[model samples]
Target: MASELHEAIFMAKQERHKNLFLNYRNLNNFPVELLKDEGMQFLERLFMKRNSLTTLPENLAQKIPNLIELYLHSNNIAIIPQAIGELVKLQSLDLSDNALQIICPEIGQLRSLRHLRLANNQLKFLPQELGDLRELETLDVSMNLLRTLPERLHQCVSLQCLTADRNLLHCLPRQLCLLPDLNELSMAANCLTSLPLDLGRSMELQFVFVDNNAHLKGLPSYLYNKVIGCSGCGLALQISDMKQLCLTLGDVTVPLPSEVKAIGSESERVLPLEELACRVLHAAYDWTCKDVKLRTPFLMPKSLLDVVQWPLGHCHRCSQPMFTIIYPKLFPLRETALAGVHRSTVSFVAYCCSSRCMSTFDLQA
Candidate 1:
C-alpha cells in the first residue's frame, strides 16, 4: 500500500498533474512525500476522502499554493491549521463528516471561496468571520451541536442556499431575511418555537423546511406558500421539559414573538396613530422610492427609514406590507395544507393590516 501511494504521487509529480486522487487509502497521516521540499505548485485539486488522516500540515498552502478544490470528507480531522486561510484561491472545500469542534477564524480569509460543507461534525459554534465570504453561495452546517448561526451571516449577500438542519438551534437571526439571493433554507429537527416574522418575504426565497421542530407552535404569514416541510411540529412539550431545554440552550431560546397583537373586525373604525403612520410611510416608500427623481426629496429619519425598510411582516390577506404592528389571526395547522398528512396539531399565525382586511381574511383564502 505504501509503495502504491508513493508511485502514484511520483507519477503525478513527473507528469505535473493538476488533480490528485488518494481516496480510500486508509492512511492515518498525510504522506510526507507530498509535502517534502517545494510542494506540488501545479496541483489544482486534491481528493483525500475516506482516509484516516487526523490533521492537515501547517505548510499545506505553501506546498500547494494553487489548490482550487480540496475534498477531505469522511476523515478523522479534528483541527484545521491556520495556514488553511493561505489558500487564497481555494474555491470549494468539503470537510464534512469529520471530528471538527471549532472552526478557525482565519477561514474567513478565503476570499475566493464559493462553496463550503461542514456537515456531520461536532462543531458547537462557527466563526463570525464566515460572513466575510462575499463570494460564498452555499453553506451546509447540518448535523452539528450549534445553538445559533452567526447574525453577521446576513453579510453573505451572494449566498443562495443555507442548510443548518438537525442541530440545537433555537432561533435564527432575523437579519437572514435580508439575503436577496437566498432561495432555499432548511432547519429541520431543531427546537424552534417561532420564526422571524419577515422571513420568506423575499421574492427569491421559495422553499423553507422546518420539519420535526416539536416546539414550533406557529409560522409567519409570509411563509404561506413557501413552506415545504413542517411535519412533526407543534408537539406539546411538558412545562418542566420546556424549562429545562430553555436553560440548556441559554439565551438562544428567546423565540420570535407570535402573540396575537389585535384581532381586526368591522367594528374597529379608528386605526392606531402608529399603525396609520407606518402604513402611509410604507405606501410612500413603495411608490416613489423606486424612482430616483421622485425619491430625492422624500427623506425620512433613520429610525423610520429602518422600520419601513424591514417591516414586521406582510398582511396575509391583502399582501400589504406592514410595519411595527400587526393585526394577527391564528388558525389551526390542520386547517391548512401545510399540515399535510401529519397528525400533530400546530397553528399558523396570519397578519393583517387593518380590521377591514381581518374581517374578510380567511385561512383557506
Candidate 2:
C-alpha cells in the first residue's frame, strides 16, 4: 500500500505536474507495510523534518542507498543508529533540536558529508572518530553541555568552520591550530579562563567569538592582531613575586597564575594588594619610590572576612564599623596606626570622633 501510494504520487508528478510538494503529510507515523526497499531505490532527497520519530527505520539507507540529503530535525530521537555510516553519497544531515544524547561512532564513516548540524541537543561529549570526516566543511554543535573536546579533531583537514558556543568547556583542544583551512571558531559561554599559548598562530583563522565568559582571564598574545574588541591589547604583563596576579577591570575581577593541576591539593593563586597597588602607581609615575596604598574594603583579604564589609560586632567601642573609615583623605596610612595596639595585624581600627559630653564621661571612666 505504501509503495502504491508513493507510486501514485510520482505518477501524478509525471502526468500533470513537473514539481510537487508533499511536506508534513503525516507520512512519518504511517505503517503502510509497502515494499519500500525497491520502491525508494532511486530516492535521493527525503524530508522528514518536524516529526515525532524516536528512531529511523534500521534498513532505510539500505533501501535508499543513493540518498544524498536527509532532514530529521525537531524529533524525540535519543540516539543515532550506526547504520547512518552507510549513506556514502550523503552530503548534508540535519539533526538539530533533538534530544539526542550520543553520536554514533559510525557517523565518521560518511566521508562525503559536507554539512552536519547537531545543535540544541543534550550531548555531553562527541566521538573522536568524527575527525575522520575529512570532507566535512561546516559543523554546528551549539547549545550543548560539552566539557572537553577530543584532540583528534585535527584530522578533519578540510574543515573550514566550527560553531561550538554555549557549552561548559573550560579550555580548547590545542590541536585545533593545526587545521590550516579553518576560518571561523566560536567558543562562547564556556568556563574558559585562558586560551592556548599558540591559539592565534593560525594565519587562516579570521574570526573568533569569545564573549559571555566573565571568568575568562586572558587571550593569547598573538590573538590581539585579529581581535577587534581587545584593540590588540592582550593580557597586560606585570612583575610580582606573589603567585596569583589580581586584576580588576571595572566591577569584574580575575586572577592570573591560573588554576593548574599539580600534585594533589588544589590551591588558589593569591597576590598581596599592597604589591598590586605599587605596580599600578609605579607604571604611570616617574617616582622611584615603591608606594603601597593602605588597604580598604575593596582589597580586604578573603581569608579574614567571610562577607564583604566589616561588621559592627568586630568593633570594641562603637556598634558601627570602626577602622578604615572612608573620609576625605588626610593622607591614607600605608599601615593602620592601630596595628601597634591590637594584635591580629589590625586589619581595620579607627577612632570614632569623641563628642564633648563623651569626652567628659571618658575622663570619669
Candidate 3:
C-alpha cells in the first residue's frame, strides 16, 4: 500500500465517499493501508481492475462491509478469497481473465447477486452451491476447463444467458430444459455427444450455439427452427430437412400419442400437425364439390379412439368452421383390395369441418 493511497483513504473518509477507485495500479498485494482507518466501512463499490493483485484481502468483509459491486477483472488472481462470500448485498462481481482454479462454495451466499462473470479462467469444477443463486440472470463461464455443469443449475429460474462455450462438456443436463426463462444458450466447441430431446420446447429460446461439437450426434429435429446458429453439427439428412421445414412451415410434429407408440413401433414415431390440418381442410373442400347425400359417424377401436383427436384449425376454403348438424362429417372405409383405388388393406379416414366452407371450393364447377 502506497502512502499516497493511504492518505487518499483518510481524505475519502473525511468526505464520506462511498466509492474507492484504485484501478490501473501496479500493486502486488491488497492495499492493507486502507484498513488503518475503519472509515473504509462505508465503502459500497471497489474499482481494482488491471492490477497485479494475486489475491483479495482475507478480511475484506470486516474492512469494507458494504461493497455492492466489485471489479477485479484483468488481475492475476488464482484463488477467490473466501471473504468474498461475506458481501450479502453484492449485485455484480467481475472476475474475468484470471488464473482462478477453485471457486469457494460459499459463493452461493450472495443471495442478491444478479450478474457474475467468471470467463477466461482455468476452472476444472464448479461448486453445486452455484445453483443457489436464484436471482442470477447472466452467468458467463466461457473459456474454462469445465466438463459438466451441476444439475441444480436449473434452480436459477431467472437465468437468461448461459455462455459456456469452449469447454470440455460432453452431455448437457436435462434439467437445463426446465429453465422457463432461458432465452440464450451457447455451448459451442464442447465434447457434446447429444442434446436433451425437448430442449427446443423449453422456453422462448431465441439464440442457441451448439456448433463445432465433432462428436455430437444431432439435436432434436425441431430445434433447428428455434436456433439461429447450428453449423458444424452432425444432424441426420431427414432430420435436417424437417428442421428446415420447421424454419418455414414444417407445422412441427409432436410425439405419437402414448397409445399408438407400440402399435406403430416400426414406423414414424411422431406425426406432423400440418398433416391433420390439411386433411380436414381438404376434406371439407372435397365434401362440397361432391354430392355425398348421407353423412354418418362410425365406431373406432377403443385403443385408437383413446389417442385420436382433431387438432383445431381453420377451414381451407371459406375459413368458416362447419360445426352444424348438416356439416362436418367422418367417413370410414374398411380394408379391401379395391375399396377406394389402392390394392392394399390400409384403411382411409376422412374428416370435414363444415359444409359452408366446403361450398367455397370449386366455385367454377
Highest lDDT model number: 1
Please, what are the lDDT tens digits per residue for candidate 1 over residues 223-304? 7556355431111222222222111122222221111112355432343345545555565454445764565345667545
Report the C-alpha displacement of residue 221, candidate 2, in angstroms. Answer: 2.0
lDDT of 3 by residue, 112-194 (tens): 88999999999998899989999998899999999999889999989899999999998889999888889998998788877
User: What local lDDT score does residue 105 receive in model 2, on the 0 to 100 scale?
Assistant: 91
1-365, model 2: which lDDT tens digit per residue?
Answer: 45654775666434533222334544555222322435455556666666666777667677667778887778777878789899999999999988998999999999999899999999999999989999999899989989987788889898888888888988889999888888888787677766777776788877666655545644564453453121111112433454765567455454532222221443422222332232233232323334324232134354233222222112122222222221111121224453233333333221221110010001001
**In model 3, where do residues sit more than 4 Å from their true spots?**
1-4, 231-365
Q: How many backbone clashes does candidate 2 have?
A: 2
Clash pairs of candidate 2?
Answer: 323-349, 323-350
Alpha carbon lDDT of each predicted model: 0.73, 0.59, 0.63
What TM-scores do the predictions have? 0.65, 0.58, 0.61
